[model samples]
Target: MNLATSPATQTAPATLTDFFLKWEKSQPEKIYLRQPVGDAFIDYTWAEVGQQARRMATYLQSLGLPHGSNIGLVSKNCAHWLIADLAIFFSGHVSVPFYATLNAGQIQQVMEHSGCQALFVGKLDDNPNRWAGMKPGVPAGVNLIGFPDYAAINDADLVPWDHIMATCDPLQAVYQPQPDDLYTIIYTSGTTGNPKGVMIDYRAVAEAVSHTSVIMKHNTPNARFFSYLPLCHVAERNVVQATSLATGGTVYFAESLETFAKNLAVAKPTHFLAVPRIWTKFQLGILAKMPQKKLDLFLKIPILSGIVKKKIREGLGLNEAVLILTGAAPMPKSLILWFRRLGIIIQEAYGMTENLGAVSMMPTNDIRDGSVGKVYPGMAVKIDPQTGEILTKSGWLMRGYYKEPTLTASVLQDGWLATGDVGTLDKDGYLTITGRVKEMYKTAKGEYIAPSQIEFGFADNMFVEQICVAGQHLPQPLALIVLSDMGRQAERIAVERSLEDTINALNPKLHNYERVRKVVIVRDPWTVDNNLMTPTMKIKRNVIEARYDAQLQPWYENDEVIIWE
Candidate 1:
């Protein structure tokens, strides 16, 4: 299916692959990707990337799979991941990306659901046990191709990337897909149940990337992006991969979790996007070096403030960042204001996989205290008057949930994607998200409580790292918290006093039903490995509730304001 046959192509923007081919010819020698090796960097120029991708495309074509076959890409962020994606596009296949952190069961579930014909395994967890657990997830019939060994073990039976490059010639006939052709299937980070596969077409990708470029003011080729987040996620895929391809920007990949700070320092990315947890970690790291009281005192001095902010930015490897964004979850307003004091403006974006994650973004300037900025130019947003649910319509919305017509119809009705999030729009069109439609739970008092709104109240407390306000069928909501690094290191008496103070100050503001009955400091942290949190750092409310529901009554009955788990 070629673009020439479609009328939509006449006015539609160039697709991601189109931009790649353009760059391959126009500036073949320009550095396109910088991948870190231990203590050094391996740069891949446009020509180098093109050559490898074309060779891989030829190999994939030789497999004789049906056109538009679903190909699985399992990898952490690396140069080869992008190359493999391009190869999939050139070979006329739909790419299905799995989160690198997925366990064996999750890998098998997505692999089986997507019906992937081939799986490209690349950089994964450095821990051998993790990779061992994931290896069996690939079904027997699926062809396996392994990238150069970085962290994952490349079994002897799998075809090596080097072998394909040496044996296969560059594919002479490249597949040119139409605007409506399926591009990729992104699985949601399912917090509740099985993740749904969102099918996005080439036109949606083009529209999302192009519109986001304009919104971010990153149209120039000099833009630099750091790719550390899970590329499988829609936000990272659009903001980092597709945006870079469309804008002719350079992309840098982090080597590993241990070396993330070092790798980021080298990249000094012009545009950086991180989850709220990451921003909190950065804040905590800074505070560890210079206590908040001391830093506040320095910032009060006009001359010292500038120096302090500059040093902090450079230390965090964001000195060159023109745009820093946070999303995938609600960020605390207090955290945004705290960064502002350091001259760092965090633009909180709002979107989901169903909308190609391009519904709205906070403008660099004109940031509202509690709102997630205005809607995009080509997007239509309306709140369900009764439910306060945010519904959006856009040209770039996903085609549907892959192979789930019933589910697709439920969310995508009459061209409007029900965001499943409740929010209010101000007179000026700024959006303030109240809570998720499904996440809100009713207390025994019959009043519904929005955990997210109540959770935000504790964001200003540095002692709290992760929090979930969950108490369904209880008289009042209870706060389950994980202590921050600072909190863990502080004297227990000090930590308890601080948390008690936070609850006391916050409870007066909330309704009687919404007030937190007790503050439970969970001993174990929720992590992706433990399945308590999603890959993006969002706590799984259902999972958390199931784990602690039996003990909630006892904790509530206890007289202590702060209970240690």
Candidate 2:
């Protein structure tokens, strides 16, 4: 809503490769990327990264691939991931990224759907089961290029990473990408069904990069970012990779989950972004060291509170952070407020794959607790008169779904795309998301229910790791909860009693249709490997409901307040 705008530099780079070249010319010796090897980090200068990417691009060109061909990239976050992406673009190919956690079937579906002529493999994930499914799914006639680490996948056409880098010289062809040129096809990590490819062009990327630079106040090259989130997601693609190229900022990659905390400390990034799940883990880690009551008492004091906050921030490796961002899922307001007490104000953002993840974000200086800031400049937002759904149009919006014009037309209409989120804007233009349009369900009594609101209502209960409220056609809604490690280790009866008390406390705040009448303590938590969550960690409600479908009728009929499943 027209806050004091700190717009990004108008003289942004023409293209991603153009920025790489610009930085290489101006600041060739500056450390642009860092990847942890063993006990130490390996740094790459701007010139070094440019040279490696050029070699990779030359290798792709030597393969006799036609211009504008599709290339698939399958890997976790790493320095090579960025290099491979730049190589693909430099060689005039469109990069199609497959999530590292995708199963073989999903991988096959994406590769075949995108018509990828070649696939690049980097440090694969640890889950052997997911790899097993992926190994056999490589399409016939598609060339395979492996990273240096070479996680074993028995491919006959595999070309080693070292061979490409050592054999191929730097690319000499002076290729340039137009603003309207298709850059990449980012598939949506659908929570309910198959993923859809979102076609993003150079224009959209430029627009998003410029806006992000302004929002982050990344006018200088000193902005440091720790890249741990899945690089395949639009959030990471735009924020870390695109923004780094735009601003000449440095990027540090996390080696693995074990090294995440240590890596964060090493990088001491100036800007940080995380999902709600990661934030919860951080809170839990702090609580393990000190009780909440003790923490509250310390925060109540004056000078001690400031010292404690500084110490806590330093310990968590966020002491240098200028902005902390939370998105990809709804964060509980209670959780946000709790972090504020520790002298951290998390700015929640709202956007999706279709919009290049730049719709609205809370400004750093003026943040409201429950709102996700105002509509960004050069973007128009409105609500559907009938459905009350959020609609937006922006310069960075995707062109359309790849080869799925009918599906694209369903969402994008008359210069505006339905956001599929139910939300309201305050008079000051601050947006508060209510729930997902597709997530609303009606009970047998013809009462509508918004599960996310109820789920977040009980999120303050520390013992709960995750909660999903479902009813469908049932008479009443029920919550399927997975306990935190502390809750699981505690005595079962005590955990159940605490849960019942929490339910009793939350019920009075809900409408008749929104009350959670029953609670099921699930034995196992929902995970990406289990096909119950997207790579971004959003729960697949249909999958979860199907897993417990047989027991739902019985649970609905039973009179127990807390049902142990």
> Model 2's lDDT to the true fold?
0.84
**Candidate 1 C-alpha lDDT tens digits along 1-565:** 0000101223677888889999899989989999888987889999999999999999999999999999999988899999999999999999999988888889999999999989988887556666678878878889888888654635775689999999999987789989999999999999989999999999898876666667776665488999999999998997789878876789998888899998888888888999999999999989889998999999999999999999998987898888889999999999999999999888989899999887778887677888887777677788887788888877789999999999999999998889999988766667788899999988888899999998998998899999989889789999999999899989999999999889899989998888888999999999998899999889999999999999998998889989999
C-alpha lDDT of residue 465 in model 1: 94
| Predicted structure with the largest lDDT when compared to the true one | 1
Task: List candidate 2 segments past 4 Å from native.
Answer: 1-13, 128-132, 153-156
Where model 1 places Cα greater than 4 Å from the true spot, the runs are 1-10, 151-153
Alpha carbon lDDT of residue 445, candidate 1? 85
Q: All candidates' TM-scores?
A: 0.97, 0.96
Model 2 poorest 10 in a row by lDDT: 1-10
What TM-score would you give candidate 1 relative to the actual structure? 0.97
Cα lDDT, all candidates: 0.88, 0.84
Error of 1 at 108 (Å): 1.2
Error of 1 at 370 (Å): 0.3
The number of residue pairs in model 1 that clash at the backbone is: 0
